[model samples]
Target chain A: MAAAQDTGGEAAAGKWYTAAKATYTTLIDTGHAISSAYQLVNVPSGVWIDERGRIVRPSETAAPKNQELKIGGKTINTQGDAYVAALRDWVAKGESSEFVMSDAEYRRRVKERSPREREADACFKLAVALHDRGREDEARQWWLRAQTLSPDNWNYHRQDWSFTSEAGKKWMDKFQKTTTDYYPKLELKEKP
Target chain B: MVNRRLLLFGGATALTGAPQARATVLYGDREVELTTSRVEKGDLWIPFGDLPGINEFSIKPQGACRADICIPLPKELKRKGWLNLSGFARKVKQAVVNDGALWSFGEIPTLRGGFPESRLAPDFAVKDRKGDTVRLTDFRGRKILLLTWASW
Candidate 1:
């Protein structure tokens, strides 16, 4: 399944959905509620669900195939191939899949919301609500609070920054200097 | 022109008593433009009797309660014979993000922890291109690679 964390509904997100030629269901999240519900802080995030509708894997940075970039004399590879291979293996093996995280591991990886983080989600929802009503000045203030409360969430930054003139520049600056790793290194393990 | 004419354009005031407030209230994840409210000493007050229609926090003998959850309204909140919704929210530990006029209330204090222990994904509904409501639970009994992307 595919979902857009875009707040503009069809006008902003529809073209991408069309261009992707997605065979799966593509949803438009105007309120960003889906991400909030999953406690996801960034896009290109994925969650794996099993036949019983239980989360086998929690939300994490997901890049399909491979992403190899040469920058500043360093090759940055986001092991998307390994993730995809693990996913395929899960499809083949179901519960017995070595790709599936054990209960202990799952608990370790799953984001348990902090009180402040929970408040941040609420603030985010309110910001969207204010923005929808054309009260953008108020919306910006609330969004900033949300960002401050949970600085790791790039979705909050991107959503708010899109309204500014230097969106791409702002994004690059933040991405370069922000304390959090661009993509947190996944330690997907196999049962030994 | 007509100097004596009282021009009320939406919420704006031509003849000043005090500028009419254009307050947008976000309660229980729902947003609505408050139809009736007042400002006192820079604090906005919604009438005690009008709470139900405004944001579903009705006035009860026990205090302001929504279903089982109730916050005892302090006497200060009852100043000028009106309910201080923001005051009540603050007392209850529910966040209220504001910018003078727009007051957006956060989650119910009891509902702010996180996802359930079952690890089942929280279901949500959104419209597809076909304008039909699509729910996450609809795709149950199958493996799902739920991915989120954005145009920006």
Candidate 2:
């Protein structure tokens, strides 16, 4: 299952979907409702749902398998192989997998949404709505509010930044502010 | 002088470029066309139908609620049989963004916190590539690896 959070609607998502030729179920979340529901602050996140519809793992940074890339002459950290291995173990062993987090640990790992963060989501949604309606100036105001309210939600910032040249520069500035460990470390317990 | 037809075309292009107020309310999975109004002080107002009509939250005696969490509303927030959504939002400390035409209410805190205890995943419907609506509930019996990404 896949969800695209682009404000440009299904067409924007379709371009990539068509290119990938993915056989899995793909969906578009033009309003970013999934982000709000799952407490996802970034893209390329994954959630594991069991056959019974219970979440075994909450949203976490998920990268593709065996990716190798260099950015600005520096090697980008790709935990794709490790993540894929853990996922495979879980798939093979289900609930008994050591890769699965205990209920308490899972609850603790999932970040609590603060009032400011919730507000930021609302502001970002409004900005997207406004932008879709062609009220660019008003959308910009709400986008700025969203960014200020939830500085950590890169999706909100990046979505708005893609629309304007001025915002592009700000996105770069914020991106550079991230520490070396931009992706959260995925802690998978070894099987006994 | 340039052709009069060219001059008229340029004027029409500029007219279309100007921003216009849209009358729509987007909440949850619904996009409803609404008749929205602003108070004398510029506060936004929407019908009660539009509130619960689009988003997950409902207006109950305990105030606005979704699942277990409820944010109590004040008396002044309800006026003229319409909800001052912006006012109610402020009372609950939730963000409300209005563009003089469209009003959006932000998320409220969950009951158990942290995405609602990971019980049943909230069901949502979205269009697939072929334009058919695909729902989350459709995959209930199968294990799902829901991955979120973007083209950008």
Candidate 3:
């Protein structure tokens, strides 16, 4: 999905949309469905289902060797070996094999998000609404809450950065590398 | 050779031999109605949802139809003989052409997050990259996602 900054993107999308017949679908943030199901550890994950509504492949759909990240002068994180093997196996065994998961196993393996994650989703939504309404500062507060609720989620961080200035982008880049610095950890009293 | 092998190994299954079933359909902001008998040639037709334009910042569904490929539907919908056209279509752009092969929704926008969200959030009305108005609810039973990015 298009992230809004002071600069406009709709023009670019419109021009591209008019010239091409192929449509593109983009997810803003994968809230809980993906994290719970397929146990997605990263972005751009895939789950393939057969014609029978069965997951022929469990999760980790991207080709292991396909990952390449070299932006500017820095390198992004890479997938591990386990991630690669699972994808390779799932690709070859689409339904009808031992690798094929049963309904119960699939459901169980796809971890359900806790109430915290659900709340994070709501926070992100509220942030989006506020940002769209031009209350960017207010949106950032909600986004900050979302980040606290789900530290692993990149959507909240990224959306906030989209509105930031060049300096802000640099800060975000550093934040991605180390999240604890700016958004500090909160010590809590656990319930017995 | 490796790619082909990988496709066979990685969850790619052929649907050519399977019995044709009804496909999900959606119109602008409404679910297209259908009955078992009304389905033709394994295809379910829906009305126009909205003309392609750059109004909103994000597309609804992230993986439905992207650049010439129709993301395969989950088999559960096939078994029930009906898919949530409204829910599914809300995620992508899948307008049908005369040839029967599904058309991919074109590029609209991109979000600026270093990573995507954990779940696909409900579609909302927003301005596109070019500052036009678009709504996800307009295309029920279609796949879509809102894609936006920062200029900073």
Candidate 4:
């Protein structure tokens, strides 16, 4: 969304689409009757509530849907067609579409988290709490815990890293697997 | 390892000898300041970003949790005793900045809900598709139900 906004494509694409999507998803899918995302420390997260207002979904991926982004040929970026197709599918099929998932499925998705992955969630949560309470040192410890648990999740790393300056980024570089690991490693080194 | 000790309370502050419990803290943008205490006794939940502002406002004083400390929200932190997030942020020196574009928080919500709890419903102020300021808390005392649909 920010990328879209940066290129002055917000009008063609929609400016608040990202914020709206975030809010819409939250109210429709969480234990809170409304938005409480300030506490969200991870992605693909959900809360289940029974018809009786009990939380049928806890912190888990309620919707087990995903998209495989592949780019081929001359385009420098992925096309929006898949995104648009997904939108239409969501509106046209509602929950029946393979795109739309059920609470049961979502819960199962969350349960799929391995001990290390679940521990990563806990670490992320602890880091957020510590960061919020001004315990930078303690928060860093938990964040390292999360990174050790799952090294691929970018949100945890990016959000935390954004706070520091260039100097700080350099300091964090030591812990991270370098920029190549983050982006698809384009460098295919010759046999040494 | 920090002993994996449970923080005393879920969203409340710890009282020295309380068993390790999850706690909540409102960190300042800079690490120089913190409102640390033991974790409060509740799920360290952050509301979704779109629900009526009242929802997040209500939780302002409800008690938020961190790893092992929970800091009670000050009455002044509330707008008429409800959650005033911007005010809370300001109290901690994290001045709220709109930047004429997006209103972003530098931090993520603490997870006090047991493992497998995702799908955050946080309260935030952002421009709509038309660039109008939308405050989720504005829709209070209304009998409306929310449904979420996404493209993953």
TM for every model, in the order presented, reads: 0.75, 0.80, 0.38, 0.34
**Per-residue lDDT of candidate 2, residues A15-89 (tens digit):** 888889989987888777777777787888988888887888888778977566564444556578888888898
Per-residue accuracy of model 3 over B78-142 as CA lDDT, tens digit each: 32223333223324432221112211121111221101232233334444434454544555543
Tell me the spans in candidate 2 whose CA falls farther than 4 Å from its real position.
A73-75, A165-172, A190-192, B1-23, B36-42, B47-51, B56-74, B91-93, B111-119
Q: Which parts of model 4 have CA positions greater than 4 angstroms off?
A: A1-79, A95-111, A166-192, B1-152
In candidate 1, stretches whose alpha carbon ends up further than 4 angstroms from where it belongs are A71-76, A190-192, B1-29, B32-93, B108-116
Using Cα atoms, each model's DockQ against the true complex is 0.41, 0.44, 0.07, 0.06
**Comparing 2 and 3 by DockQ, which wins?**
2
By summed lDDT, which 10 consecutive residues of candidate 1 chain B come out lowest? B8-17
Better of 2 and 4 by lDDT: 2
Total clashes in model 1, counting residue pairs 3 or more apart in sequence or in different chains: 0
For B36-112, candidate 4 gives per-residue lDDT tens digits of 21211221222222212312322423553344435467754332222444454444333232211112232322322
lDDT, candidate 1, A87-169, per-residue tens:
89999999998878777777666655666876787788888877887988878888899999998899999998987788898
Task: Encode model 4's per-residue lDDT on A1-192: one tens digit a residue.
Answer: 111111112433343455556444222221111222322223333332322333322332222333333332211222234434544564465444454444454454443334455446545555655555576776677667666767665445544564455635543553243443222211111222
Pick out the ten consecutive residues of candidate 1 chain A with the lowest summed lDDT.
A69-78
Docking class of 3: incorrect
Better of 2 and 4 by DockQ: 2
Better of 1 and 2 by lDDT: 1
Give Cα distance to truth, residue B141, candidate 3, Å. 14
The sequence of per-residue lDDT tens digits that candidate 3 reaches over residues A30-145 is 12223322333333344444433334334432333434456545444434344456434645664434444555554444554555564555455455445545767776777788
Q: Give TM-scores of the second chain, every candidate.
A: 0.61, 0.65, 0.20, 0.27
